[model samples]
Target: MKHFIQQVLYALIASMLLLTACTKSTPIGSELIDQDQVELKFRDDFKIIAKSINVDSVKTYGPQENEQLNSYLCGRYEDPVFGKVEASIFTQLALEGAMLPDFITKEGTVILDSVILSLVYDSTKVYGDELALPQKISIHTMFEALDRADTYYSNQSFGYSPNPIGEKTFFPRVRDSL
Candidate 1:
């Protein structure tokens, strides 16, 4: 009985660690990935990551409103001759908490009059700046400054109104190249 109890405890601990480890970005390998795999993983993982974001309120922007996302098609070039340059083009908005590193970035914090979290995960099934996405993607909200009865947002001019950036679509090496 004691041995069985020990095994159960060990399993619980291992499962907890595994769950925590997966909350961050997905692991990528240099091996070539087929477009189908990219599409499947990108779609599935994106949904999962979006479900991870925690926000007081959410309002999805672009696409459904007969609009195109102002995504950024950035490329990384580090030649012994050419210098570093990065560019951002059309992109869309995402939900809170599920912000990823590669594709998406830290736009700013969002506030709301009430804590509405159900819609925080609905920003999925959409593409990022690029026309296509890569295989295996994820996002993390990381840090946040949430407060009720106060709706103070950093960049309220355009995006992040009711949505937070969970995942983004961008070049893998864009950040490093620049």
Candidate 2:
């Protein structure tokens, strides 16, 4: 019986080695194909409209009318033809759910470590030479709670501290990967 078990184990190991050796090492499309011989067809269908109109006055539009339009940050840009344009963003943070399982409570007084705010910029939406120019961003804390029932607009104003909580000066870098 001992000899039979040893023979079976050896046969199984040999089979596994043979299967692994037979497997392909490289992917199916590793070889390059000639692009000149391949004929690719492409088509683009779009329309562009250009019109000149006087823009003396403008009104603010709220989220109630257009639910899709919303901004959480504001920026200012100056163009040679368009002059100076200013924008502001307001946001509120909320807790998603209950405390995590690993959350621990200390017996004595607990001290705060540090608070961090991270902002991610969308590369595709960026305009102008952001790489060459450095931007100074100021973050202010809100004085009052934001109203969930009321619709917010770009031109609307909210109560916030006159002094900023923190400020940072940095150049924008496009993120390529996660």
Candidate 3:
């Protein structure tokens, strides 16, 4: 009986030790993490000056098939330093995947109410310091579709209506949220 009691006491002690040994693993480098430190060095050894460059001829390239543009720009600006700059863009609109619902289609003579064109501006993609100044902009309808087969360049011209569809004069205000 004494031997059995000793055996049972040993089994209990072994089980208690096994239970105590089992513990959750701690992640490495998790204890008391230090904040990141950054150091910057500045040197003013040489004087910087702007130089004027005269160009006899300048060449421009067009957009390729592999390249993709996010926005279509159409505007003309006259800068004292950069001279006159003009840009025009063409886009294709299609409702391929977006189909009208059956309920909307069932209703006869669906009259259009209003159309609104919203343009989101990217602050980081600015070129000149004319954002604060109010500029006149005119929008016209394209007469022809942009050819997918041909490459388009900055100097290339597209057919557009002579009359302006809309015109606005406002200062560009860059915002974080649209």
Best by lDDT: 2
Q: What is the lDDT of residue 75 in candidate 1?
A: 38
**Cα-based TM-score, every candidate:** 0.16, 0.50, 0.47
Worst lDDT 10-window in candidate 3: 54-63
Tens-digit lDDT track of model 1 for 48-154:
32223335432223324333233323334333444553332222234555565544437665443343222111223323443243422223333443433234332
lDDT comparison, 1 vs 3, better candidate: 3
Give me the runs in candidate 2 sitting further than 4 Å from their true place: 1-73, 97-114, 176-178
Q: How large is the C-alpha RMSD of every model relative to the true structure?
A: 24.4, 16.3, 16.0
lDDT for position 25 in model 1: 70
Sort by lDDT, best first.
2, 3, 1
Model 1: ten consecutive residues of lowest lDDT: 116-125
**Cα lDDT for residue 136, model 3?**
69
Please, what are the lDDT tens digits per residue for candidate 2 over residues 95-174? 55555335456865454555676777776677778777887777788877765456654556788898987788877776
Per-prediction backbone clash count: 18, 0, 1
Cα error of candidate 2 at position 115, Å: 3.2
lDDT of 1: 0.40
